[model samples]
Target: MVVLFVVAASVFGLSSEGVRDAVDDVGPLAPLVFIAFSAALTVACVPGPLLAGAAGLLFGTALGTPTAIASATLGATAAALISRRFGASALDELSGRRVTALQDWIAARGFLAVLYARILPAVPYNLVNYAAGLTRVPLAVFAAATAVGCAPRAFAYVALGGSLDDLGSPEAIVAFSVLIGMALVGLLFAARDVRAARAARREG
Candidate 1:
């Protein structure tokens, strides 16, 4: 995680001009590097939003969106596996009730939970990945949902970043608006689930 953070910070610090220069200089390698950095960032718990935005700024829509999705999915899967192997007990100890509720919810709707969590920005990406690891959700299901769920946001970021020529352009504003709407919808569903779980627990 520490290593991941360092890599992410370095990537995030690149100036827009620097990013464009690097892309021009390195050409094809830029997407590969961006993907690698994005994976590391996700593992380090760097915010997904930052990564998505950076992908756009660095690679543009054509390459950035796919790179972000692939990197994020891989990073998330790796994090989930590692958390399950080494940090499950610790996580359970720290977030017992919430974890239990999440576990139950995942069991009931494993794919949907993964999809919703990925789609929404309400919960940190790392937390959701780790939580899924602690649950009994199938790996294939988790991976598939994660890949699909991350697409919209990833594309949005790439689109926003690609439109940098006109910083305040209608395209950028529309993309940002769409991202916010998706995030809000995800949060609403998550909140409803949490509330239902709490109510059930109280009733029981």
Candidate 2:
């Protein structure tokens, strides 16, 4: 693992400009090459946002958004499967009511559950990737939910990165608006849930 990371780092470099240059040098195959590296690096714990930002810098918003989404979904799916296979087994041995409850909740709600978590801004993306594997949610459902739920933010983030040098650009404006809108929506959902929970407690 360490050797692989070192090799990739040497080949791609750690800077936005460097990775962009290296991948771009691949000519027509650049997007595929970027996707491969992005997926591998993400599995190694590299932040998805960094990759998405790099995508925008490398390919602009239109191309970068889809590229980032594919890379993130592929990588996140891999990480979740890894955790499910290894981590889930270990969790199974430990056994706790809380664990069961979480697993069941995720399993029962399936796509929507994963979707809601993915849509929420404060939720950590990478953590969800690994943790989802431990639950009973089907693999296909997890991947689909991840792609759909994350698409909006992926576009917004890519646009933001692409517009770093030109914040006045239309892409930047749309990106900022989407991000803020998502944040507000997440807050509203959180408040509603809180109220519901409080009401339930009172009734109980």
Candidate 3:
């Protein structure tokens, strides 16, 4: 779905300026439309970073941060719920004792589990959503964790997007620096967590 959208956008010569113009033309309904579009695209596996950047490009950091956060929260919740409902049996079939233990741990600390996953650069947003669905974590807990955990990266990218046209400017440079820093921190944590998970699996 995302690939198709990208292809269509490319084929049609759709640029950020075009998207910005269209979003602006929508006037008062722009925020709602943007949220809806963001959620849908995200659920379809569109890259969250791209969407966050686009939000910044379209609405600037002040509005884009919250907009991206809200959209991502909504999208993650929607995917989790849908996967839980439709894929429960498949998930059960795939689950082993080790998987069950992990699920139990997540269930016991669902919010933190989701928060950790959301902040991990190596973990894809959609994959976390689907994986969380297989756990006993409540939707509200998952959504809350996603909102808080996603904020920093979302803000950084949005800030970068807001300053895209002036990359040499102080604000743009700062935003870019912050974005790289966030990615590095996230990647480090992600690598650590992957190692821990692997070790636990071997011990099991």
Question: Highest lDDT: which candidate?
Answer: 2
Q: lDDT per residue, candidate 1, 1-204, as tens digits?
A: 213433554566745556777788886777888778788888888877677777777777777789888888888888888878887777678876877887787878988878877877666778888778888788778888999988887787766766655547776777778788887888788789899999999999
Clashes of each: 0, 0, 0
- Between candidates 2 and 3, the one scoring higher on lDDT is 2
TM-score of 1: 0.75
Candidate 1: which pairs clash? Answer: none
- Candidate 3 total steric clashes: 0
Clashing pairs in 3: none
What's the lDDT for all of these models?
0.76, 0.81, 0.81
Worst 10 residues of 2 by lDDT: 1-10
Quote the lDDT for 169 in model 1.
Answer: 78
Cα-lDDT of candidate 2: 0.81
- How well does candidate 2 match the true structure, expressed as C-alpha RMSD? 5.6
- Candidate 2: which stretches are off by over 4 Å? 1-24
In order of appearance, the predictions have TM-scores of 0.75, 0.86, 0.81
